[model samples]
Target chain A: MARKRGLFETFQERIGAVLPSALQEAQTRVDDRLAKIPTRLNEYGYDAFGLHPESSRRSLATSTLFYRHYFRTETFGIEKVPSGRVLLIANHAGQLPFDGMMLGVSMLLEAEPPRLVRGMGEYFIPQLPFLSWAAERGGNLVGTPENCVALLEADECVMVFPEGARGMNKTWDHRYELQRFGLGFMRLALQTETPIVPIGIVGSEEQQPGLMNLEGLAKRLGLPSLPVTATFPLLGPLGLLPLPVRYRIHFGEPLHFEGSGSEEDDVVQRKVNEVRAAIDGLLQEGREQRAGVFR
Target chain B: MEKVLITGIGSGPGRLLTERLRTRFEVLGVDRTPWEDHPAEVAVHVLDLRKKGFEDLLRTERPSHVVHMGFIRHFKGDPNRRHEINVRGTKQLLDHCHRYEVTNLVVMSSSYVYGAFPENPFYLDEDQPLSASRSYPEIRDLVEVDTMATGFLWRHPEIRTTVLRPVSVLGPNSRSMMAEYLRQERAPTVLGFDPMMQFLHEQDLTDAIAMTLEQDLAGVYNVVGAGQVPLHTAIEETGGVAWPIPEPLFRPGVRMLFGAGMAPWPPGAIDYLKYPVTLAGDALAQAIGFKALFGLEETFRSLRGRG
Candidate 1:
């Protein structure tokens, strides 16, 4: 320029010229999208089922960065999830449960009429300290039959992973393999007369690849499992960071069954097998369509 | 005119109940100390319920209705004194009420008697066991007083006893532990738990007591406000910050503060903050035809230096 500005000053001037408009444009887009959501439908109220509006809004904003920018998550067949009182049954894997967060994001951002999907967490979630409170505030509940029935009765969309912890702790050699499903969710679907939507989440299995598990150490530390990954423990806390893998979420058509929610093992198992087959079918289809693991 | 004897007049709800009932009935108040700002229409008597002189006052007043609002809550005094006043004093009062042939007796119990446990159902009805004493010895007196009152109710059908187990009472003038905790600049919370809580306004509870006295309801009822909120959310709405600490460290921290006389609550009180003990008020509504004028939000708002 006229005064022969320094290199730092030149860079500062360039950033100052564009940063405000860029930030304002991003803010406006988020506000417009949020304004479209029916925020008043806190049918359970602000903290109902432990879903705090402030906490949830903040958590979702942070997760959105990972969902859109880091993972570049793409959702397909989102319209298949019916409105009101439906159960979302999905495959669970990855040492970390980012899959649940991704599915929640897809429902909020991509669904026709954005719905808050309440996820049922594992049994050990409530035992943890800060994680338990944060999880609840983010609209996750302890997995229990009573909680599921109450949520459905309140006309909420609930997401569940019937595979439980077994699926989430799979080794690197067994990636993408679906675990045996628990039958409780089937009984819940029948009891509430709610339709079920089978979801197949690809890429989450490869997010945090587990090589081995240290059971004794994990038990002593009060953890479900101590996973030894390529980057974990070896790299300390930094190793816990998930590798950026493109996520593809497939939501299948809703399936409805008519029966009394019974505790009989055989009766419930038959229904569980049907839902399991649907998810496995979707998982296979998603794999065939993928260009590559990281694509 | 019918006469009513209201005990624990020094407490907020007791005084409020006296003010509301004085216009309709001749009211007499009995407490360990005198109420400095009570209405002139009500006659106040200074005496201890655990001591020997209350029986004579009962004989002299011969009140048609007796309101037992004098139970010593844990935060106000020493544990031993609270136990003696709550358990033994209640027993003595019941014996005197039976002997005097009082037509109606209303006792104030707390929802805390149900105890805050992990496995509790969403809404605790009147039939739920008094489990608070199991974990916290501080609330043992409350369970005993409740047991004695219910047992006395069956023994003397003519008394027509109604035990009102209300949830946390909060207002501009409330002195309950919950109200005091909410009024703090920063409310301490358990690191891992955010239990749903219900609050009833002081006026609503007084109104319920008035109804119980005016009517002939004769069973235990759970009195609660319209709705509930998570403990942290309530604190946030009231413009207070939540100071969360780990569960293991919380007890020892409270103990240190208590030792220095800086903490307002006992260490045993941490259990309530960790789990929920919310009560369903449907039974109270059905029994007394009661509906809360202030919802849960309004109740919390009232605690922020406004009525």
Candidate 2:
């Protein structure tokens, strides 16, 4: 059993030695940010939603590469994200969820005091293989109202994308145009008495540049949408990789609505529309400010 | 001392519960299978719950408290026979409880009755519908039994009926599917899915039962453990390597293994491996001040070898 170290073992041993100084610094920053965030972990060091600091570190370390170099994400008014029990409502795009990740990275690295933002993901997220537990470990829970209420009650920051699949799967022609917002987030905010921070993301829509949506194919494949992106069908799986577009994220002022959560559909929709219009304004402002998608 | 008639006293939990309750109440046991070694203080009756002899035993004993836990929990038995004993037997027992004026009736239900669906929220309350049978038809009998006991609770207000839907109970001698799954050196898991799981230490469940009788809580309540953990973490904590299989192969594979009597749980139990069925124990805690003494690590460790 006393064998000499093989070439593979030698390479593995030098992982830390080989890592660039930028990566080592990023890893330290991720660990430090994660340590400062207060989580109600059980004795086994996992939250109810399976968010562990160890898992978060690995996920964040990988995301840090894309956040810093790939996307070069810039944030504005991140300090407007109130400390306790608030919602970060943003427009979701990029056939994948890089927008959500960038928003989360902004909260962790850019926001004052570095808050941990829990993204309320779709229900089908748990059905996928590796993405299932990875999302949970990254602090993204299934977007059930009860889960949202529980997290808000615990005084944690929750990020919500009211447009859902419609926004994420929209074609390039409909880019920067907000879809119909779901009123569930408004109802939850009202019920929990939590403030909503409207946010707008600029460059994610240009990442994949979806041409058209194949709804029937998506249904048969059990996916939300099968977007025929410019690069996807042409380049196959390689095309699924999003373009390195510069991301401009703007966090608007917190919006608070009054009344019990049992309001009529129109009443809730009106509140939802107000938040949607705020996001539209932000999106327009972001588009006008950015020189180009790659800038 | 007050008399408490316990059904399914032959099972591991039944025996543990009898030992825990015998000190305070006069414990009499009933089960279709014989319990070979039982304390002399507790009378263990080996008779089918549907048989007339069982009703006669209840009538003659006239026990004021009845704890019904006699249903077969595993899928190894005949379906028709299992249903007959679980459903028909529960009906007969409830009739006897009403006729004999059993002041307190505690039906040992499980959180599984809620069903492990992706739509299930983090902390399901008591009022949530019993939708387990929707996906898992094999567990329909348990759901029916819970429904019957709940109806009995409303119909007979005199008898305080407490239907406890506790999370998976685990311990050294636990015959629970979870305990059996953890015992495996390579436990198969659904690839990509690791639902958060809750575990109640066997002793904590026994205490909850005892406390239920002492307090006479009348309603359906979800008895949660101290906390929850991911399925993979629980497997690791119990010294088992999680063998993740894709859903397509894992479901039918488990089904075949179960049909051949090689696997511990049925194929329908795979949803549990995929989605969470976490419960809110706040009701029980607020009602009886119930707090679990054992943590998740200790609970998972109990499933390891008794050594």
Candidate 3:
């Protein structure tokens, strides 16, 4: 039988034959250098970690690292960010919660972007030395009102998903549905009257297909439901892993609540609804754009 | 059982009510300004919530009840100014409230919110919806709701948030038309027979606050004091005569003089010339455990620099 060889394999074989030190070359090009920033910046909740491009050289050296990777990670309507200490709210998508991570990375890339995001929960920071080093320098942490206000007062941008755990755990059955958002964000916004910048993350769900509901297994595990994708359950290990799908992030304009004082119940409820609606609209827009990408 | 911190405690109803409850409570008094010789004042801290680092102060002195009394009458300036403290700073305080589990809260609102006029009878009760009126008072209404929305905390009750609107606090330092006339030497002037006004003495105002704190109430209330009379009569009772000032001279001065930060707004001023805004709240007063401690006789008598 003739040996079956494809164009991708043939290209790899040719590279291996030409440069016998191929493994070494690949290792040198993808070295992960995560350095810690000054503690003062950390105190203010700033992290430089992997954010700084390898400053020693340009495209050839490691300096343009974050830029090369993230420059391609596109975002739209960032001008919609509300000025001042605002609650940066967005929809939660994907089982791994990469949506939140990329959003934080985008803010760091912002021009004079207020001290990265030094306010979020500690759980999101992966324990890996390289990732943690990057996160520490980047100033990403937990999502609490106290932390949010501290970050805002420090002039650092703070991001929070009002739906908390439930929102991020959204499955295929309810991809864009919002769980009951904790009213804490609303209260803080009203009390601080911080402008709210609604962000929407699409394509994350497609990256990790959530196809089915395994009722018996999920109940024993105590999760909302298993984080499965459309064809994943049949794929086993690959099913649990995320597909490298294209992603899109969109931001809606800032909303300022004119009345910051005691509101009648109806008025308060209405304002909260408006903010939620804006986020929903942005999410739909992002999904639509990502849909066209697939077509 | 819960630690309550009331700021701007040296003046107005804030200090009086705080002092009364201080003996039995762990109350922290904060004010940026001086005490101005208030008779009943507990230990007070000089600090401005409006200034930055408000969150730092809150983290250090975490109290359950944050009765915000520091904000003044006027809400004009940079449109973004009120958000500095009224909204953002208050959020900083609420963040501490949640951190320390200091759930109970009672913030003072203005009866001028009867201005929202949400297509209903303008009785200024809990029933009226406080929509945005693009005015300072209306903004305060929003501030109240936003603070209350922070969380449906469970501590003293199912939820802990209350807003009190005192219809024209009648007292010594008040800038009511009666107050302004007291500062002047000549007779008071009426544009078109200033509308009847309600009065609530400092003590009565203080007492209402004390009652609200003691009861640990949630939601909104209109604390309208009894015994009201026309603005001119109210001024006359304060030992000033009414001289009808012509629209020509009066209009410019009202526009120029009172229009500054030292004065209140239109309905706050000119609205008095109309029929008068009677703030009647039977259910609210009953719910909060308050009795009209000062009547027209007492409120009028007290305005002459007397008890």
Candidate 4:
């Protein structure tokens, strides 16, 4: 088994041979961070959620390229994230989930005590071929309340995009504008007694400028939305590639709310609103601090 | 010695359970099928559970404890016959247990009754609905039997009833659907969706049953194995190659093959392949200190050569 190489690992090794010094440094850094993170693995070296350190290494190595060079992501207040169970509530954007990747990488590379952030993906995620398995191997699970509660109970860090698809499908005109937040996260926070860390990410919103959203076509094709960007529908799949944009991630201090999680709907929504406001505040700060989108 | 009447003695775990329980209790076996082999100490009764003869045996023998495992599990045979035998048979068995004044009843249910859904929690508790019939309609009989057993638990408080919903059992002596899937050199799986799967060794299942019989706890409990593994990883560990078929082509293709008698499971079973149905064994663990001795590797390894 040690002699074998997975397709991803082999591709990474080929990349490593070309880059040599830089890629090797990135690989060691990723390995070092992963070694410090504790997880309950079965005899076969797979966590209950199908996360294997070997698979995560390959995934992190690929993401490190985007984090370090492609995006040149700068993280702030990563130390604000408290140890033990935490719910990192962030404003989601970027037609794709580059924002999620950056936040996850921030938690891994920038945090004092590096923590593996388990991302909650949309329901449609599991239906997509290859992505579903790869997502699980990378420690991102289908965003169900039960999955979140389970992770929190186990004292693991969980990331949730309360804005969901509404924020991801926002047009370029609506960038940095927080969408209606889902109250489920607040209820979960109350239920699990886990703290919520508001995260604000800048530059992901400008990755793909959405001119118009083709709701009908998206519904027909069974997609979240069909955005008519400057390049998309014109450049096809290649157009989906996000333009190089500097990413600034801001992690805020932990906010604690006390409740049995069975509170009234209005109460939960109010608490959710508080979280949304905090994220909005952080997004403003991130935007003001960044010199420019590319700088 | 306390007498224990075990139904479905002809099945894979049936014989094993009898062998395990014989030392502590005087074991009596009953099954519609014949228990052909010679066992001088244990007596075998070949009778349909729904028939009058089973009631006669129960009344005469008067076993203090009853372990029911006689459900028809396969998708083969007439659907009506399967339902009648599984559902009606269980109702009649419960009635006989009540009539014969049996002190204890252990209904061997399965975690598959909860159904495999993308929306299912990682570890489903006993309270979760038996929604398997909605997706896998062929197993409605199993679901009905399980539901009936739960109802019987509360209605008949005098008879201490325990329902054991064990995860997919696999081993050399196992005849479960999961075991059959792993036995194939090339197993068909839903493309793109690799759900987490749990497996219990047949010996561990028997051990759970033995433990349940020894304890006085009465309620519905999920009997899980050591831990869980991805479906594809489980296939590889068990020495089987996964043949991933796209969902669009997989469902209908499986149905066609099943109709032609070339497939192990019907199309309904595809949902299970596509989604996870993991269960929490904490209830049983805390109740009787139940734990599976076989790890995921050893459990999968058991199915290697037998295939």
Clashes of each: 0, 1, 35, 0
Report the TM-score measured on chain A for model 4. Answer: 0.95
lDDT per residue for candidate 4 within A236-286, as digits (tens), equals 999998989999988888999999999999999888888888989999988
DockQ of each model vs. true complex = 0.20, 0.50, 0.00, 0.52
Candidate order by lDDT, highest to lowest?
Answer: 2, 4, 1, 3
> Which whole-number lDDT from 0 to 100 does residue B30 have in model 1?
94
Model 4, CA-based lDDT: 0.88
Segments of candidate 4 deviating more than 4 angstroms: A1-22
Q: What is the TM-score of chain B alone in each candidate?
A: 0.96, 0.97, 0.77, 0.98
After best superposition, candidate 1 residue B138: deviation in angstroms? 2.2
Task: Give the range where candidate 1 chain A is weakest over 10 consecutive residues by summed lDDT.
Answer: A1-10
Which wins on lDDT, candidate 1 or candidate 3? 1
Model 2 achieves a DockQ score of 0.50
Ten consecutive residues with minimal summed lDDT in candidate 2 chain A? Answer: A1-10
RMSD of each candidate relative to the true structure: 6.6, 3.3, 27.0, 2.1
Worst 10 residues of 3 chain B by lDDT: B115-124
By DockQ, the best candidate is 4
lDDT of 2 by residue, A248-285 (tens): 99989999999899999999999999999999999999
